[model samples]
Structure formats: structure tokens, C-alpha cells
Target: MPLLPTPSYTTSLLLSNGHVQTLYPPLFRKVAILDAERVRIATHDDDFLDLDFLPATAEAACPNADGVRARPLVIISHGLEGHSRRKYVRGMAACMNAAGWDVCAWNFRGCSGETNRALRMYHSGVTDDLHTVISYCAERGYARIALAGFSMGGNQILKYLGEHPAAVHPAIVAAATFSVPCDLVGAAKVLDRPSNSIYMRYFMRSLKEKMRKKKELHPELNIEGLDDMKTFAEFDNQFTAPIHGFRDAMDYWQRCGCGQFLSALRVPALLVNAKNDPFLSPTCYPVYTARASEFLHLEMPVTGGHVGFIRNHEDGCYWSDLRAVEFLRQHL
Candidate 1:
């Protein structure tokens, strides 16, 4: 459980601090154009998950004498209010595809550019949907499957692995996560700060919009004053917690935070967090837990704000994307 050396992640001197390191790339990085086969997988509760499959590039694809495609698969779960089409998701998918791997970037409910049928939306701790996605991949006979998630998605992946360590599919060899908010209660406090208000505003706008749409679709559900809720904690207290069966925002965070469950994970997992990330609290570092667990590896870079891990101005590629692929390849 000893802490591994900080992975080789160098933040651009030009992009100083956590916010710049986190926001610059998403705002200016060249868009990654991908040709993906979109598949809608049905869930047990009759809802659905939208999955975008990017097959390995021809140069990277491995085929047998019978022309059967054989490549490792990487399942990517995006952050809050993010979908498979987001720039970072596509960028990482493209990287994995170029490295001789099939990439499936699956969207959480209500995130895939379509309204989800269920009244309940996805939360940081939700794992049943992840289980469904993994089952789909397992049934397809993938020889090696790795999982990667960003921010809130990272929290879900860790929670899933920890909560159901014994239930992981045999093909799921490893997992990687970036900029995870391991401590949800602490993260809420961070997001509530004035310095991080930009992010809070953006997220609240999206959440309110989604709630408005949900109210329209299900008029019977009471979502009154959703528009007035200004902060993440308030929004979650009014909607997310009750809809998902938690008592309130704090209760939801307490029950769902990944920090409490990391010790139970059995998979070879790599978790990367930045000391300067605006979204995390000190408790999110998980230093002691990582040092005590044989299966978990923690990488704490000095600066990589949120999900941003840009190395330099010369190369637009993300450090987290490359490192995630490398970590998963080790187990593959």
C-alpha cells in the first residue's frame, strides 16, 4: 500500500494554478473528431444507456486470419453533465482507439442528448448502470476490459469497484480515474466557494434545465422552485437526494462518497488527483488509504485542476488520458 511516486505529469508553466490547468484545455484544445457507432443498451428498470463505440483505428486494429477484430476495450465514463461527445471524452476515446483499443464512452441517464424515461437521474454513487454496461461488454466476449472515468464519473467507478468488489467481471482487469471528488461532502463545500462559482453556475444551469425537462415529461412529479436553487448543495437537497432516496444533500454525499469505500476495492486501480484541483477538498487526497491498499495506486500531481492535466502548450494531448491508457495496459 506504499504510495507510488507521482506519475510523470507536468503542468504547463503558462497555465498556472488549478482553474487554468483545468479550464484552458476544454476551452481551447482542438476538437477530436470521432466516427462512432451509437448503441442504446436497455437497462433492467426499462431505462436505457447511450453508448458510443469507437472501433480501433485500422492501423491499430488487430485481426486474426478469419478477420475477427481482437482488441482490448476501454470503457469511459464522463463527468457531471458530460456525455460521450464531450471534447475530453472524445479526446481520450480517440487516444485509446489509436492505441489498438476499442473505446466505449457511455453516457449517464439524461446526458446522451436525449431525455431519459426514468424520473431518477444519475448520481455520483450510482453503479447499477455501470453494472449493466459491463455486462453488455462481457456478453460480447471482450478478452480484456479496462475502465476509466473523470471527476464525478470517477467517483462512481470507484464506488462500484469498492461496493461490489466480488461482483466485478473477470474480463475487467484494471481501472483508472482522474480528478475524482472522492470526498463528496468536501467537494460540495469547494464548489460552493466564490472562486469556483463559475463551475457551480454552469452545473446549476444544466441541472435546472434537466429538471425543467423532467417536469414537463412527468407532470405528476413535483419539482417546484428548482430554478431558484442556486448552489449544488441546495439543488441536490431539493431534487437529487430525495429522488435517489437520500435524506438530503449531506446525507447523499455521506452515503455516496468514494473515500469511505476505497479500502474494499479489489481491482488493480489507479486514481489520479491534483493538489490544486479546485473541485476537491483535502480529504479527497486519500493518501493514507492508497498507501494501505495493495490494489489501489494513488497519483497526486501538484497541479492538474479538476479533470485537466495538460502537459504543455506544444502538445494539446492530456496527461491523464495517456497515463490512464498506460495504467490499463499494464494490467491488460
Candidate 2:
């Protein structure tokens, strides 16, 4: 299998560094207002995933009056601790909807504005929930389906595509992922850096809060040292690993990292990783593997940080969102 040419991605000169590019958009950019229709889908294990559907504009709607014109559908999976309503998620949904594609932005368990019934929370590698979401779309008779994921969600989608190469749904034509940390262990180490302490603090606050609530609901579950934990690695070791059945954080990262699965992807997929992204390690680039695989397209820009790919101050459109829609449209 021959490699696909590396795609080009231009970043804003003003948002020069990784942190500025990454933090600026979510904090300062104007959010797209969406009238989302929320739907709760029950999982096989009795837990539920909350999904928000945004239909295309009237001009972009299906040609058929019955709404069956082989309309393309895009399923977006948010990053860790991120819900469907996040500004980036809404921005992407709005762009796709305006381009004649129906968007389904689904939230991971315990992230849909409510605590999940089960003791387990979503992890970087968990793909069963994603499978369930895709299955739901498949059963609905969608003619073309594409996937777009951010950060941890990107890892899950890539892992799902690689793990189930032979079982991929016929309707799922392509995928696009942004700021993915393909190497889980490396990502944890990067996040533990002293300079990244602010990010770690922000994330831990949400994570610990969720755990505090989880402990309250499931008293029978053994989760000690929740208060003393400081780093992400520590929290994963204490809770994310054992509660989800891994021996420890290292074990979970080794077994679940998506880098090990990229070579097996059978569907066309675009992976965009900014070289300056604060959350990624060198291994996350996967340049060699992408060059050898027929289906994978790797795009590494010099500046876009984390999930931030803001093009410029004047035009608020994110480079990732536009590129994702463009790539998916090519396959459609």
C-alpha cells in the first residue's frame, strides 16, 4: 500500500505558539449558537449516551420531502471531560450542518450533564460507546457516515477503526481526527510537566469532581486516595485503571494507545497533529506508519496547538473544522 501525500494546514501568524493557538479560540472566539435537539440512547449495559442532533439548513436539507435523499451524516465525538455543548463541538456541528450534512454530536458517559449509572467513566481508549453510537446511525438507514473526533475521542475512533477493520460498518465512509494523543503514556507524561501544571489543574478539577460524585453514588466501589492524587497519571492509576479493569495506568495506556492500531485501519482517515501541540509526544505523529498505510493521511502543521487550529483573528473559522468537512466531502 502506498502512502497518501501529506496534507497542508496553514495556521494563524498571530496565534504563533502552541498555548496561544490552543487556548485562545475556546476562551475568546464567538461560539456558534445551535438549536440542538437532544436524544438519549440506552446502551446494552443500561447506561445512556446523550446525543444532540442538528439538521442542515433548509437549503441544505435533503431533496426528498420525506428526508430520504441519501443525505450524508457526520458523527462527532468530544474529547475527555468535554460534552456535546462545548464551543468547539458546536462550531464544528454548525459548519457541517450548513454544508448540507446532518450532524450528531454525542457525549461520553458521565459527561452529558449527569452522572452515569455505572461506576466506569470514559477513557482515552474506550470505543464500545462509540461503536454503539455508530450502530445507532447504521440502523437508521443513513447512506453515508463519517466520523470526526477531538483529542481522546480521536484516539477512540482510530482505535475502533483499527481494531475492527473487518467489521467496520458499510455506511461509515471516512474519518477525521484533530489533536489526537495516539500515545497515551507519552501524553500523560507531557501533561505532567511543570509548565503544563495549569492544564493539569483544570482537568483534575473536573475529573476529581466526577469521581467525588461517583464515590457518593457507588459506596461499594473501592476508590481510595482520591483526595491525595495530584497528577493525571496518579488519578488514572488510582481510579481510571482499576475501576475500568486495567492493572494500572501504565497497563491501561500500553494496551489502549491507538498508535499500535493505526496500521490496520481499512477506511480512509485523516489525522491532524500540530507539531507544537502541548498535549502530544513525538510518537503521536506516526509519520512512518501513515506513509506505509493506504488509508491513513497524516497532517502535521507547525503551530496549531492541541485542538486549536484557528486560522486568523478576522475570520473566526477554525482550520480543523473546515478541513474535516472538506475531507469527508471528498469521500462522500
Candidate 3:
């Protein structure tokens, strides 16, 4: 398929800048999560992933005139330090439900408002957790499935598809992602900048707090010197790599970066990474991979910061959510 044309998302004059665009939604956007029935599924390793499901309304669940199946599922993955209830995830779930699809917004381990039981937690790569989610959905008899993810979760979707093109469930037909940090090595560099210190501190604070709680359960966990760590390099090297079975931060970034896996996606996938995303590196935009691949449709908009694609809509859906629903509906 041809690459997507440049999409338009106009922020207010006050929010035109990347940082403002990124910060406005979380600081101000409010999208109520209605009728989200939380389901907990146990992992093989005894860890758990929490999924918030919004089933398609009965009016929207009927088969199409063409007799296409009803109840197609869209599984959405959240960003780093994010959960199923984040505005981005909740908004997309609502949009999908409105468009006649069931939505499953999954929380990465330890991100579901409770620290995960296992000693280890989720990371940038970790497609195995996604596999467990997909497989669980498949077993539940959903005949059609699509995927949507943001940032770290987006990287996981691409890596999951690329790592196992032939191994993907037949039910999964399409995918859409926004603001992905696909190139982890470059993303680390981008996050280390002085301009991004706000984001760095916010994330480090959240991660460190989780570690403090996790330490209570797994006392062997080292929570020392977390106060000194400021960047992903410092924290990932000290904690994430050792706990998640990587040699170090560099090895984790190298092995887990989704840039190396884009060309291998079998399902029709839309990756819309904004050019002005403050949280991403230029390497995160895989122009070559998208050009070479038949399935991965990479759309680089001029402005969408991280997961923020604010749209002035009555339904409270953002531009990113609407765009994903637009792309995914074509396949469903």
C-alpha cells in the first residue's frame, strides 16, 4: 500500500508548539471512561495484565449488509508510565465503540493502579505480554481483531508483528499507532536533552515510586540511588536491564528497538508519528522501512506531540483517536 498523505491536526494558536500540544491534553483534556469492565488475566509467569473492555453496543454489533462479521475487536496499548484509564486510551476506546467495534485497553504490568506481583515489570520491547493478551482474546472467540497503541506500546505492537509475522493470530487483521518511540537508542538520547527535563523528571518520579512499592513485595529489589538517576540511560541501566534480563540499557535499546522490525509486519498497519513529537528521535521515523514494506503505512504529520492530537469534537475524541478509527474501520 502507498504511504499515507500528510494528515492535518490544527492546535490552537496557544498550543501550536510541540510541548504545548503534548502537555495540553493531559493537563486539560477530560474524556470519561464509561462502562469499562475491567478484566484481569494471569500471565504464564504468574504476572497479570489488566484489560478494560467496552463491548460494542447492541445497535452497533449487528453484521454489515455485506455479511461481514459483527463484534470485531480493537486492542489498544498505552504509553510508558500510562494505564488503560489515561485520556488517550479512554478516548480511543470511546471512538472505537462509537464506530461499531469493541475496545480492549490494556494496562502494562504494574501500571493498573497496583504494582504487578512479579519481581520484573513491562519494558519497551516485551511483546510476549502482548501475545498473552492477543491469545486470551482469541480464545474468547472474537472473529476479527485490530490493534492500536501509543508510544512505548506502539513500539511493542510493531515489534510483536515483525518478530512473528507468520505467527500472528489469523483474527488480527489491521493495526494503528501514534507517537511511537520505535528507535529506543535515539529516543534515549532525545529524552536526555535539557529541554525534556520536565518529562524525564515526571517519568523518573513515577517509575521510582513504583519501584518503592515493588520493593515492599520483592525486598531484593534495589531501590537505592534512584534519586540520583535522572535520564532513561541512568535508570534503565541500573534497574530495567538487570530486572528484565538484558545486559544493560544499550543492549535493551538495541535488541528492543522496533525500527529494525517494521518491514516484517504482515497485517495492514498504520504508524503515524508526528514530526514535531518532542518525545521522539528523528530515527523514530522509519522512512526507509515504510517505503520498503508493503504493509506498514507510515504517516508523519507536521505536528502531533507524543500522544497528543487534540481535535475540537463534541464526542471528546482527539485527532489521533479519530484517525485510528478511520483507518481501522476500513479493514473491519
lDDT of 3 at 147: 94
Count clashes in each candidate, considering only residues at least 3 apart in sequence or on different chains.
1, 0, 0
Residue 11 lDDT in model 3? 73
Off by over 4 Å in 2: 1-8, 58-69, 313-315
Q: Can you give the TM-score per candidate against the true fold?
A: 0.95, 0.94, 0.95
Per-residue CA lDDT of candidate 3, range 1-332, in tens? 54777876677777777898899899899888577778999999988889887887855434466655468899999999999988888888988888878888899999999888999899999998998998887766677899999999999998999987998878899999989998899999998899999999999999889888999999888778988888888889988999989999999999998889888888899999888899888899988788888999989888878888877778898999889989998898
Query: Model 2 lDDT vs. the true structure?
Result: 0.86
Q: Using alpha carbons, what is the TM-score of model 1?
A: 0.95
Q: What's the C-alpha lDDT at position 281 in model 2?
A: 89
lDDT of each: 0.86, 0.86, 0.88
Per-residue lDDT for 229 in model 1?
85
Model 3: weakest 10-residue lDDT segment is 60-69
> How large an RMSD does model 2 have?
2.1
lDDT order, best first, reads 3, 1, 2
Residue 236 CA error for candidate 2 (Å)?
1.1
List all candidate RMSDs to the true structure.
2.1, 2.1, 2.7
lDDT by residue (tens digit), candidate 1, 79-140: 99999998889888877876778988999999998999999899999999998998897666
Weakest ten-residue segment in model 2 by summed lDDT: 60-69
